[model samples]
Target: MARASSPKRKPSRRPWRRRLILALKILGVIAALGVIALAVTVYTTRAQLPSFDQLKSSPNGQMIRVHAADGTVIVSLGPSYGEWLSYDEIPKVMRDATVSVEDRRFRSHIGIDPIGVLRSVKLMIANWGTDRRIQGASTITQQVARTIFLSNKYTLSRKAHEAILALALERKFSKDQILELYMNKVYYGGGAYGIDAASRKFFGHSAKQLSLGEAAVIAGLVKAPSHYSPTADAEAAIGRAGVVLQLMAETGAITPEQAADTDPKSVALAPEPHQNSVRYFTDWALPQLDMLIDETNAPLDVWTTLDLSMQRAADTAIKADVPKGVQGALVSIDRDGAVRAMVGGKDYVSSIYNRATTAVRQPGSSWKLFVYLAALEAGYKPDDMVVDEPVTIQGWSPRNDSGHFSGAMKIRTALAYSVNTIAAKLGQDVGFHTVADMARRFGITTPIDTTPAMVLGTSEVHLIDMTRAFASVANKGIAVTPYGITKVTANGVTIYQHEVDRSHVLVAPYVAAEMTDLLQTAVATGTGRAAQIGRPVAGKTGTTTSNKDGWFLGFSSGLTTGVWMGRDDAKRVGGLSGGHAPARAWHDYMIKAVAGRPVEQFDTQVTLPEWQLEPDEESYFGQPDNGMFVDENGYPIAPGTYPGDTPTGPPPQQGYPDAYPGGTYPPDGSRTAPPEQPPVQQPPERLDQDWMDRVLGRTPDPDRRAAPAPARTPPPNDRSRGP
Candidate 1:
């Protein structure tokens, strides 16, 4: 307290004045040092600045690009879109709109606009405490500096560099040259880097051909390419164009009448092209792009495995068949798994979901192929009979489409008829897990649940995977991995190439032939009958319960195709069955898809000689709970087979003997019939023992001399009705 009293009287005002003087000196030195530093920076930049020639050489640099298989430019993945255009090539309206909106005093300003910078500072202060760019203080020249020379930062040093560079650019190049560089270098929407690319992308015309409306739209995109892209969102683009038109008119760049008329003007967008089918294939291959780049970093000329003609066919077929709200996907893979054609959806612009490769849905009866293939592997034959009566497993009872049983039917008949009860019974005979393994072996990567419902197609899978599995059958059981890229080259030098890869045979040749025969029966008469293309085709039609989804999976000797139709929302399509739309659409598409090509039939023999064999008694009945038996032909009996004839029991079950499509006379010919039983009741078409003896090439009895190997004609409806 005593020191405070002394300080109050003696605390020198001199010390305060001296401190103020010292602070002023420090500030003066700082201002001088800042001016000197700025002058040095300006001198250094001017000495090292890139010349106009250097910039002109690379006015439109870009990264890699993508091309269609036919050498047409599909789309550019690079930073730049199309070729560079000179100022003369750029439309006047486009230039006017840009000047009016981006820099009103660009023509009169030396390098920087004082008023503009002041307004930008005011805007920044208004939006203080944030780093957001409220408004750019750069003039057109400053924009060029920021685009080509300086970093995109809001700090004072960065702004100083930008201003220095702009002055240097003005000293080195004419205003027209600077405008040309800006026009050719600015980024537009959809990978378009310049006015030229933006013009073509939005109007399907070059920059020189841009109309007032198109020019205004492109000018508006300068603020934000993606946000103002007409192709992405037309309403936003149109609104931006209106603002540009108003700016142009207010700045005396155009009359008010012109602004009114141009504001009302709408963009005349080009129609969606047919070649866009390549998008689906390219979208799939994009993931592999990064791994393909070499040390040169040059754009690769990648050749794909797409058949544009077939792709168009697939697209046309889907668009023609699918209803308004329903979506459909189609995949056509060659026997080698080359994805020749893929229609991921009815319209890709509406959705890029890629249903062919990504969307997984239940296949319904289409999954029976693997189930029946598993049955064949488990030693069940096409001719073996299974009771068509309903049965249950794990509290799951599946009924045939027709609730009434056909009593007893052959495995071939059951498959051709799509009898659900028999298929479920066969799955039980061959474990459901075995069925899943069969699918995996066939290149179905999607997970398969092993359960009673698996045979009924409860498992979900992508259409491409299903097509790949079916392609294995078409290619004689060799599992194929679907691939699109064939070769990648640059500067006429081959860099990356893909070799044909196929997995070991997962299905035996004989088993494949048998499966093909059964699937052929489906196309011949059953649910897939609509897929017939007047040629030998094999496939299955699948309609899920409640008709939520439909599928038609089919294959020729050369190509395998799968079609799927459903609502994206998973709502039921009510009356649309696989046979009605999917099969018919497949038939229509396949007819044209396979046209101008030779008709190559299946690898299997179509005649009976290949399948017919000598009957053996040991293969005659069921193998207990296994649900499979051997026929007289020494082959496993049908998946539908049961213990119909016990050999020593009462005359074989009444309807059993007639089920045989062969030449035997008695159902229990190897064993004597019991005394109480009457002669076996047989169909009228049943062959007598004397005729069977002749058909077996046996010598005729003296009392009833028979003809030579008798012509054993199966029932006329056998192909459609099953063996």
Candidate 2:
């Protein structure tokens, strides 16, 4: 026993090896427990997750984005989403900025970055119980999952859910697809849900139009939208954007010189509109969706013909001039019939009704365009003499707004002054049916009766239609079909394309030119002078009975614009006339609308008739003389008959020349009050053919008839001279 104890006395020196083995065993058990926990988390999250297809397809998130022809955003319905741009369609700068700022390892990661997660964990642990906030390290894939499927709540459960879905998405889609999805769904503050919307909301343009600074600014909003929003604090947003640019430079997304050359502060933010009048355009355009595309759950991108600059100009002009409680509408069209700008009402939020496309009102003297067109077609010249005396047609005696006629005057002067009696005579000479036919041919879809009052625009017509008719005249006889939607695309695939057959001629070129000459004279020296833009303008002024509606429709610089101001309830507006408020609005809008455009001259050669060249010394020309020198027969009297009258003072510009002596330039009201007037002719009551049915591309129902419009009654006083 002594010998055995002596051998056991030698103890082992490698005690460290036993400790190492124990450590290995503990690590292996811990690893097993971690693996089990991860498996459980994935299993639970997977169970609660929706299918990949379900997550990708946003059925209720249908957005109809209406864009201007220049790719400006007019408005969007439902969620504010940009077009779903593919990876290639997205600008490289936008992609690089987003990737470099949001996730550094986006390209190398497989849905989740292990190093990033570990770093985030280390940061969280180091900052625990401190004032420093914990930062997240979500890869782009994880973000896509959260944006498309998960809630925004910050919780361990949500993190687990996002991670599981991210891994699943990686397996299901390529990296590029994942990135595209993320870019299209990521929130960029200010109600914008994508790069496109953010670009437009902040820069007044599209995603494709984004500059390097703009791209960086948008990318910086990913961290905290409310914090980095440019609209909130531009300096802070620029600082964040500068940081993003630096990140991009470090990542080699952009060169150091490029970063140095970029100025984050140079980015201009789009001015916020006082009221969203563009909603009127979207409201008018959204109904066309059902007719353009097949039923689909995918979001739609509707490219329209709107000109955002012109729309802004119109909104500004209308708001500045239109009196409160009264509404105004405007429509501008290109020569090709593309609707550039549409302002349906002064304020869209107060009233959802669209006066431009839906509300039908009397056009007043503007309707005389058709009557004169018919007369011109009947071989009547502008210089042809027409008597502007009181006329009766079947117990209805139509009188001028001046209550007294100017006797005989040239037809052009008659139209320029909007002489109701002269218009009635022209209607009688051309036959009322012929005038009605002319109106129909010029895009007047409302039912026009073959009566004398029809010559004065007694029938109700949509503002858009009258605008289109005037546009047709400006187009030099080619019929113009006002269209807003140019095309529609869903999921980057074009589902509908607008096609136009522009070969149809509505009138002879010569006739159109003659009409243009007449309209030009009206704008140059007649009632529409208020709408002059120091360029070649051709238009007419219209004022309804009791000044219920004021209208100015004109064209210049290859653009045709029409303006109307009135109350929604059809109540009278005192002193409101086409030459005053409406013409002023048109002038303000057109001056801005045509600012950058080159001046264009009309192709007209006036052929003054023999009678026009050798006028009588005492002949009248519609210029009001206050009856100082003549009776109602336009005859000259002796000198000193009226206040400060001198018979030697060139006998005055005789006849009704748009203005009355000591009276307003544009005579206030026109047309006789209808003996049995009906309420403002409402749109057809048929469910299938609602008011919008008359929009572009719709075939008006042949049998559809408006209520029989009665003849207008002249006002009692002479001061209310027709414009």
Candidate 3:
């Protein structure tokens, strides 16, 4: 039987072949379906994606204004919503209106709406070949995908891509999430990128507070923001709002009567564009930030050292105090050498020149500090005496501005008075090269001539450099690199931070302390008295030859400030002197600039032994004074090994002349002997008795007998009068 069955099967074995053919057909059908599904997904995703050029060039994000902690706007960048919220912030009316107009069955559709698609197709066929109007059948998910992931082109390919993306988006997110994204990302005209901006631009309110009618109007603008913008045309927008209201009624979001009663007022355009307050500071700091960041194409948020209060104070002071025909600059730096405020010119817009840090003008007497410092380093004391007599140095004889010589003045008085003759003498004594070297070491990058005139401030320097050097003094001799920025942040991360460069330059603390004391005295009682702030302040004032330049450099507890006033063409202004205009400006600014800050004291205890000067008795008496014991140039030896004889009288006071047991001497070296003492005519006993009576507050009667005269002889004049 098996043999017969096998023969029959062999005769008609087409059954197995038929079975194989059926299996191949099933496989082909499955493969075809898979290809179709993949094709649909690829077409949808590609259509929705925006081109690289559009995304790069288009302004689609939020515009945010960044303000300081005290509300001074420092910068403005695009699209900073600050924080994104969920759909809960969306008003109920807005949500309902959006759903009704954009997608009637958004709650029911998995991703795409068949009814909406059919209606849209009918409208497309009816309006074919007419460029007047077109209908969109995009659900909430589809619109969100188009806005977030697609370009702004209208085509069949874009539609197909949108459909596929909508399906994917629906699967990934809830309907509410899709709607929220659509509302937040969709453009609503008039430079508004989202519903929030739209609401603010049009109604001056938030989307969360929109009325039902306002919600309907805004919902209608989504399809054609420019065409339906109330700011563009009131009639067309009203018509579009009617359509949205009808859709709401049809979708049961509102009743027919509710739709009819919903009326929205026209939107009012914003008045003008907004500008930030710290525009100048932002412009000034951006370049500095670029240098500090140093990363390739990285966005950074710079945290600067600008004190807004101080900046305002400086600006106000400049505007109020700066005279006409004169350009001035002010720079305020912290003790750490961070520039907090700066005004480069009277008006930054009128002139782009930054006078604060860029202008290099002759510092006048301001450079005297360097000269004094040089003298100090050379074992010279502040009390050391230097004659203010005129002298010729390298064929240049400098004269005192006061037009008179002050004979034999202490160095401190010479510096306080800004006496050019004394400064020139000190510079010559210490060597011009030594003073120039000291200036270089103190951060003066300017070219200082080795001529003796340089000691009288012939060198040019900028206000910022002066400020930094003075800040170094305030910082206790620590050399700090001046910086404008402190840190930079981006995307909640600190991308750049300033590393302070602090180095000690002065040889000893006493050197700086002694200089500070002298400077304080200058401010308190000398030429810089105008800079006194009723507080402990140290500063120096400088006026160039013929009052061409005025400068005041000073410091407080937390700040170091420098001010300069001069004509842009280097002409004299108002005959202004450093002790007048520049010092007054410095005082006015500093008084208010550091009103509430705690007072700080300078280092005053460090005693410098080499700077101490003792009087030479041998030299004072005009004796031989031992030329062998003195230096080779016949000057008193410094740190002299031998102690000279001490004077028998009291030390000389400030106002009184030295009591040399001689009467006034002539300008020449000749002196006349004093007249013989009048026979020792002692004071009358009655005179002494009257002084005692006055001290004891007792009145003497006119009849009281006079006291007897002393036994001393009367003068020859008195004897002649009696005879």
Which residue segments of model 2 deviate by more than 4 Å? 1-58, 79-275, 605-723
lDDT of 1 by residue, 287-379 (tens): 575566532345556777787778888989898877557889999988777888888888777565689998988787788999999988777
Cα lDDT computed for each candidate against the true fold = 0.71, 0.74, 0.65
lDDT value, residue 104 of candidate 3? 75
- Model 2 per-residue lDDT tens digits across residues 191-246: 68888888888899889878899999999998988678887567789999999999
Pick the TM-score winner: 1
Where is model 1 poorest over a 10-residue stretch in terms of lDDT? Answer: 618-627
Answer with 2 or 3, whichever has the higher lDDT.
2
* Candidate 1 deviant stretches above 4 angstroms: 1-189, 194-275, 293-296, 605-723
Candidate 3 has its poorest 10 consecutive residues by lDDT at 618-627
TM-score each candidate. 0.55, 0.52, 0.50
Candidate 3 stretches greater than 4 Å from native = 1-72, 77-284, 296-298, 605-723
Output candidate 1 Cα RMSD: 15.6
RMSD of each: 15.6, 23.3, 24.8
The TM-score between candidate 2 and the true structure equals 0.52
